[model samples]
Every structure is written in structure tokens, then in C-alpha cells.
Target: MKLCFMMLTDLSKRFNFMNSTFQMANGYFEKHEKDLHQLSDQIWDNPELAFKEKFAHDLITDFFIEAGIGTVTKNYILDTAFKVEYVTGKERSDSTISESDLPCVAFFSEYDALPGIGHACGHNLIAVVGIASFLKLCSSLKATGTPARVILLGSPAEEGGGGKIKMMNNEALSGVDFSLMGHPSALNCCTSTITQAMEEKRATFHGKNAHGTTPWMGNNALDAAVLAYNNINTLRHWMHPSMRAHGIFTDGGKAPNIIPDRAELLYYFRAPDKKQLKPLLERAEQCFKAGADATGCTVEICEKSEAYDSVIQNPVLGRIYEKHMENMGYQFPPKDEKTFRGSTDMGDVSRAVPAIHPWFLIPCGGAPGHSVPFAKAAKLPQSFKNAMDSAECLAKTALEVLQSKQLFDEMKRSFKETCG
Candidate 1:
């Protein structure tokens, strides 16, 4: 029989925990489940915005330091970003451990929440999965006498600030072989197997203002805004089916009676990947410029946040992850039915290194993500259970990669093919 990839259909198949390391990893996560739940709750209770996750930053650092699991860096590169490193079997080694001799696996944690809708995206649970997996992986490696390095990166401001990009620019991900993280998703209706490449642009129209009665004397910036909106609407009809373009007029005008001098809008452009997104962005610029030309107004366009590349799904690592998730009782939908949920900074990370950001099912009772209902569901007890399951699987995936050079090379080959 021809096989594309096995989805861990049978518990006794590839996912058998007979491997002592995998078994030990599972035990480690099970023992730390309670602490993981509390950490999730505390972060959920205190929702901080992008680049200001001080509470989460402090809490997570303290958790690692008190446990003595790794060497913790309080403020890593960014104020809200932190890093934890643990070398398995380091204490038992008589000679100095050469970092070059060991393969490194990094896990990312995002703690920033929505502006007002706290934990709407279940980022608190994401922290649990990342940290928990890192800890579990460390424990298993130590128990098995494996020489490896593990890292946990506390990334901030994913809501719109693109914290991962900031870390990438700072070379914070340097020396890491690959990265992994799991996210919670309750939206059963239209969840994508992978996310899209996304970018934000702010357009401003400059014109002269005049009294309401003498509107002709002034170039109405609001008119420019409306025209631009319409132009983009027309452009959408010709856009690629996978591409998405939408925006809101943040500054429509001061008063209805005045011919506004300035107007502003915020729009997002999404494509399957960064390469396709570039042309779409260029075309949108023309639409905005046309709107200004028609009204004899000048325009300025600026990017609001860092651009996010589409995720390069590494099939090799994906199969490793699928094997475990399936063993944990999560079923995968047919590939054709997979839906696009939205965009994320993790997209950028995938392009940089072999990475997986699987969206695990959470108990949201059919509530769409980022909603008040979804936010409430994020803290549900079952949600943590689901989160820990992912953590266990992640650690197992790490163990397999660290133990086999051939597998790591194959994973990297897949990354090259997908990224190239």
C-alpha cells in the first residue's frame, strides 16, 4: 500500500511509549500538570498588551528559577521577552559540555493578550504548552542520559506587535536548530491547517478643509477615504482566492459638517506566502494613490506592524507531531477540508527554522476564536487538559529529533524544500 504519512492511527503503532525517554517525558508532564494549570490561570487573570507583559514575564521567569530547571535570563533582548536554557546530562559530565556537540530545540511562549478581550486567543494556554514541553523534554533527556540543549523563549506582543519578528531581528533565535509551539483553537468551523502571510498598512489622505456649505472649496479627505475603500473593493474581485484584503477607517473625519482635511484608514493584506503578498501590496498602493489623485489630495502609506510570512509546513516534523496527537485522541480532518483561520507571527518563525505551531482543540463549545465566549472557554478546565496533551506530544517530538541525526537532517531537508 502506498502511504503519504501515517497519522498515528494506532496507539500501539509508532506512538508506543515503550521508548523509555518518551515514557519519561509523559510522566514529567503528568507530574507538573497542576503547576502548569496555575501558571495558565495567573496569566489569564492578568492580560497585558503587546511589549508590556511584565506580569507574565515575571511569573514565567520565576517559575523556571524556583524550579531550577534551567539557566534563566530575566530580560532577554526585549523587555518582555525572556529565555531559559537547560542542558540535559550536564551535571553528570566530567568535561565541559560543548554546545556545538548537542542539537538544540527551542519552544516559544506568547503571553500578550488582546486589547480588551483578555485571553481571547488562549495565549495563556500557549505558555503552558511551551514551558511544560520544554520542562518535560529536559526531564526526559536527563533521565535517559541524552546530550542535548533545550530552550524556552518567552515572546511578547503577538496580538499585532510581531514579537517574534523583534526577537528574530535581535538574533535571539540564533544557534537553535528548530522551534515548536502549540496554540488553542475552539473555532471548529473554519480552521486552517496552516496560517497565511499577513501585513498591516495605514493609509493617510491629506487635503484642505472647508465649511460644510462650501464643500467644493475643500478637497474632502473623507471623500478620498471613501473612494479608496471603493477602489480596494473593486480590486478584491480580481485578487487571488486565497488572498484577503480588508480595512477600517480609523479617522473618517472630525465632523459631518466639515470638509475634513485629514483622513486615515487601516487595512490588512494577506496571501498564501510573503512572495505573493508583495505584488498584492503593490497593487493596493495604486488603489490608494488613485483615490488621492481623484480628489487632488496627497497620500502617505506606512506599515503598521512587521510582515508575517506564511508558515512553511515541514512534513517531516509534522508527521512526528501527527503521530503523537493522534495517539492522544485528536483526529485530523481531510486535507481538503482544512480551513484558513487567520495570520500569526509564527509564520515568520517557520520560514526561519523548522517549526510547528499546531492549533490544538480547546473546549470552547462552538464559540469562534477572539470572542468573549471564546475568551471564557480559554480558561475552561478541559482546555488545560488539551494543552497538557499537546505539551506531552511536543516533548516526545523533541526527543525523537534530538536522538536521531538522520531524522534531524531529513527534517532540515524538508524545511529547505518548503522554504526554497
Candidate 2:
């Protein structure tokens, strides 16, 4: 590890010597700024839901192919989710360089949208950033003789479906030393502490149905669902500050005149970590049971999604990203008492490997995320600029990981030490 650090330090000096080259590389990407914005706008205009992003997947993958990066073995993973690799200086006459000998860096790109709002989560920005960064890095490496391999990860279904998780399970991230991705947000941050642990639950209440006029003869399923909701609402006051619970009635009652024979709901439960999640989930179940008992209804609670753990940031890699962004003329906002605390499937990936999912500030002012307004601004020119900026930063950070063995070793040690 120490020897790797020495080599990395030497490489860092070499990187510094290429400041002019870096400028040219960035300029190369800047030339495509207009096309990047148009692609982002097109994606936003036609949003696809989770696991069904045919348009987004095709657009991004086709762009990469046009950029000269070859697609890797992604059929092993989901069809929509694939990997693209760019290997520098494949010998004109001989080609026998093993992938293991080459340091691998990855950029995770998501392009799924919300049901009605479309790009509300700014996945369009994410996809454009990843593609632009990969292209820029490819150009830089080909020109500067940089010795590394760049991999772009096409991750889908971030809207509640575990696409990355499944990708990891399929060993798509194997042989990758470092992963880098950015989220479009209202403020800049090197690390996002918003990764809360999460669990999804679904419940259905069965009761007797009769005409509303003969209410005395019917057991109202709607009544049971309402009671359950109230119980969970009441439970919120006593839950830990880190704990969060919310739900919506999927089926309250079909008609006003008829008694509600069936009532259904989808509930989301969040905690600081999985250890705390267990007890909180149990309490929620008890509330469901209590509602059933009180309303004389039969209730069944089913776990929808497995508990997703909080994101674990690799400090070493995070600082490296911070350096890259600073070099690219960017700064993060001051840390506040109220940090971002959202939940994501990427948290699952962090648990298995060293990772960082930082938030890049879009032009959208401290606006509420995952909202319609946020979606609209995410398609603007300013958002495209920020996305391109993040792409460069993320690409540079990945380069640091590839060239600097010290950073990679520290990230590995940190991940193992923390997980163990």
C-alpha cells in the first residue's frame, strides 16, 4: 500500500504537469454543451417510469456507442441496465492487455422518472452527466496516454426499484476500484448524509360488505383502514427523531353506498439504520393488528421491499472528489445542522462496496426536491451546465482513483474496517 501511495504521489505530480492538457480536455466537452442540453430536454419531455425506461436506455447507450466506447457484457444483468468500457490505447497491432491489470473506475447513471411529474428527480441530468463525462475522459486518455480503464454504468429503476442492487448482485461492479455519481440538487455537497434506512410495507383489510342504509349489518373495511392510518399517525409522535413513516390509501372504499369490503395501503418506513428499523417495523405491525381488532376486520400486512440501509461514504474518495470539484472551479455550501436525509437503493451498493453519492447543486435555488417545479428546472440550460460540470468533476475523481493507488487502498481499508 505504501509503495502504491508513492507511485500515486508521483502520478499526481504528473497530472499537475498536464494542466494545459486538462484544459483542452474540458474544452472538448464544452464543445458539445448545446447537444447535451438538447438531449437532456428530450429525456425530460419524454419520461419513462422505473424498469420501463426504453427510450432513456436507448438514447444513452446509443450516444456512448457513437462516442466510440464499446459496450461490455451487460446481458448478464438486466437488459436495460448495461455497462460500457473504454480501454485506452488498444495496441494497433497487438491486443492482449488484461482488464485486471487496468484500474477500473465507474460512473452510475440513472434516467427513470416519476409517474406524473417526469424527471422530477432529475434523472435526466444524471444520465447526461454520466455520458458527457465518459466521453471527455475517453478523449483525455486517448490524447494524454493515461493508463486506465473507464466504465460507465447504466443503472435504471431508481424510483423505488432496486436496479443498482440487482446490478451489483450480478457482479456488474466487479473489478471496479471506485464508483462516482452525482445528484442534481439545490446545494452543493461533497457527501450526502441523506441516506436513511428504509423498509416498504403493504397491507389489506377485509371486512363484510352491505348496503350503506343497512350499516348495522356490515363491517366497514374503510373504517379499519382509517383506524390503521390514525394509529400509525399517532405512532409517529413517539418514534425516534431519525425514524419516519408515511402511507397512502390505495383502496379506501369503492362507493359511498356500499360498505368497503376491501381496503389497501402502501406504507413506507424509514430509520437511521437497519438495527433501529426492526423495532420500528414491529411497532407499525402492531398498529395494523390493533386496527384490525378494533374494527372487527381481518388485516394482512406484507413486506414490500427489503430494508435498505443508509449510505456509507468513503471519506478518502470523498475528499478526492472535493479536490477535483475545487480544481474545476466549484465549492460546496456550508454544512448545516439539518443535513439531507433521504433514502435510496444506492445505499445498498454502499454497504457492499466503497462508494460516494454526492449531491451537485443545480441552478434551481434551494427548491424542494422531487417536486414538479424541481423537474421543470432540471431541464433548463443552467441544469445542463451543472450536470456537465459534475460530469467533469466525477470523471476527474475517477481518474484520481485509477491513477492514485493510495486513494484506492485507503478507500478499500476504510470500507472493510467500517463494515467489519
Candidate 3:
């Protein structure tokens, strides 16, 4: 009897993969593959920084307008941010679909590029993934007149700026029921992270300026800076492998002959999760404070930018996505293999809503992200298709939620357990 039940469960999954809506989603992706590539290429061709993705923003918004899939709202929350919202469910004489029948879902796109390497992080592909995913789901919704809604949100400044965090503070994501996005990597995986909890810190040391020849006349801020650097280096010996605290002296002094009155240092601290992150940051703060105490220089330490939280992957949502990807013939890596995706503002998004940040393999020839080779690899044909397939699977996962209230409840329960 147990064997029969297992067999039936497997058959049900297979049936879901073979169903009409699944085909329709995949078909929409295939039909728009060229256009999708062009959009990604255009973003790659024109690299824009965070809060300054006007070109990419205008391009995507116009594309959505031309597609006529939903209502396009440009500059929705931030200057470069935009959203396309489609109400897929409505009353129809041929069907009994209702607007509130299913939970509202959202897909995110990040288009900002690194300053030195254009699209080196493969965010161009990320933008494509979001668009492709939304299109797939939107196509199915239109076809079946399903009782649900899907949104495509373009978030900017993900490279270093916390654009998503700003959007959340402004209540942009308040009403969204579920959120989904995928990142590009050398290997495909179900979760990018619990990625990492990360924060930026800036320190300014104040002291009296004195000639180098008269060393004892005034306090040396530069000395404090050096002490802080060494102290942080020392702290690393006791840090966990998953944690990071790296920094540099942005300002040392004007001349070798003078002891500068002011010095500045910038750092980024990261941990696997927020619990570990807080203590790591606190201990590191003491290291800086000790430097100031030793050098007799006053130190002011504060956040340089918005802090990003670690992602809490929704297990129930992940299982649904895995089945769809597996059915499409994509292989998963062993559980022990380490897939390192750096920090993201999407981590902040996950804390506010149930979310998944899957990583898909792009042909990078073993070059890690944020490099020239990875940037070139991102433009390859195969990379674009891989992103599309991942988007299709994400769309399938959304369809699963749209069909069952029980599934959405399970997702909510899992979210509470994982995040709390």
C-alpha cells in the first residue's frame, strides 16, 4: 500500500509537468526567445549603475507596454525601478474564475552592473529571467483565465546599493503574496543562499595634526587606522569560514612629513545568517574602538550603506520548483557541494515575503562571477537559454500555487518556521 501511494505521487508530478498550462508557459518562452536575448544583450551592451538604469528601465517598460501583458508603471518605487502588474483572474461567462482565488505572486529583475566590469555579475541574465518567468506565467493566466495575479518588478542598484531595501521601506512589496527570482552561476542549484547577511561600515578617526618629525606633539589618526586594520586581521583568526570582514584605508594622510588629523576606512562584513552576523559585527566594532583607545584618537563608526539580510529559502516552494526543473532534465548537484553566491538585496526581500533565489548554470568556462570572463560568458546563447528554462520552472512553481490553497498554506507555514 505504501509503494502504491509513492507511485501515485510520482505519477501526479509527471502529470503536472505534462499538463496544458505547462506547455503553454514553455511555448511562450520559445516564441519570445529571440526577443528575450535581444533585451538581455541590450542591457549588457549598455551597462548602467544602480539608481541610474534609466536606459534599461525604459527599454523593459516599453517592451512590456508593447507586449500589452499588463499595466506598466515606470519608476514605481525608486527612480530606476518599474513594475508590470497583470490581473489574470476576472469574471467570465465561460468560467467561474475570481480575482482573489489565488495568492498574488511577484518576479524580480536586477539590471545594475558592476562599475568596472560591464554585466560581469550576469545581472543582464537576471533581468531576462524575471521577464521570461513573468511572461510564462502571464501567458498561462491569459490562456486559462485563471483566478490569480502575477507581477514583474525591476529592482535596480543590486550591485552595492540596497535598492530593494529602499523599495521595501516605501511599502512597494507590502501586498505581494509570494516573490521569486533566480541568479546566474557556474552551476545550477535550488537555493542561492541563505546567501549571506552583509553590511557596510565606514570609520573616521579624528585627531590633532602634527609634523612627523615631532611625533609626540599630536595624536596620529593614521596610527589608529593601521591599528584597526591589523586588529581586524587578527579577528579573522577566530572567525568562522562562512564569515567575512574586509576593508581598506580610504584616506591615510597627505604627506609623509605630517601626521594627518583625519583618516577613513571602509569595510564590508558578512555572515551566513543574521544571528551570526550581529555578533561578528559587534566584535569587529570593539577592534576599531580599541584602535582609537590605543592611539588617543576619537573614532566614529557608522553604517556606510543599507544592511542586507540573509535569505530564508521557503522549503515548500523549493520542493515544487525542484520537481519542475528535474522533469525538464536538469541535473542537481550533490548536497555537499558548496555554491557560493555573494550577498544580495533580495536577501532583504526574502525576510519580508516568502521567496526563492535559485541559481542556474551559465557557460562561464569556470570563471567565477564579477569578472571579465564571466561577463563574456553571460552573452553566450546557451546562457540565455539556461536562464529561460529556469524561468519556465519558476513559472511552473507559480502555477502550482495558483491551483491549490493547501500548497500556499504549506508555503506560509514553512516560511514562518524557517524565518522565525
- The residue-level lDDT of candidate 2 at 408 comes to 73
Per-model TM against the reference: 0.91, 0.90, 0.89
lDDT of 2 by residue, 1-420 (tens): 322234335655666623455565654466666767878888888999888888877776676556555565443377678778877644421245454556666778888899888888899998888778777776676665555677888888877777887788878888776677788888778664567888889989999999999987988888888898999999988898879998999998878999998998789899977888899999999988888888789899997754678887777778877777777778876645347467888787777777888888777666767888899889888788878878877776666665566667778898898765
Point out the worst 10-residue segment of candidate 3 by lDDT.
Answer: 1-10
Order of the predicted models by TM-score, top scorer first: 1, 2, 3
List, residue by residue over 152-210, the lDDT tens digit for candidate 1.
Answer: 99999888889999999999788788989998986321123868899999999999999
- The residue pairs that clash in candidate 3, if any, are none
lDDT of 3 by residue, 182-283 (tens): 889877787534478899999899888998999899899999988998999999989999999889899999999898889989999999877889999999
Clashing pairs counted in every model: 2, 3, 0
**Of models 2 and 3, which has the larger lDDT?**
3
Model 2: pairs clashing at backbone N, Cα or C within 3 Å? 194-340, 194-341, 194-342
Off by over 4 Å in 2: 1-21, 24-32, 72-76, 89-97, 335-338
Candidate 1 Cα outliers beyond 4 Å, as residue runs: 1-19, 22-31, 91-97, 187-192
**Cα deviation in Å at residue 223, candidate 1?**
1.2
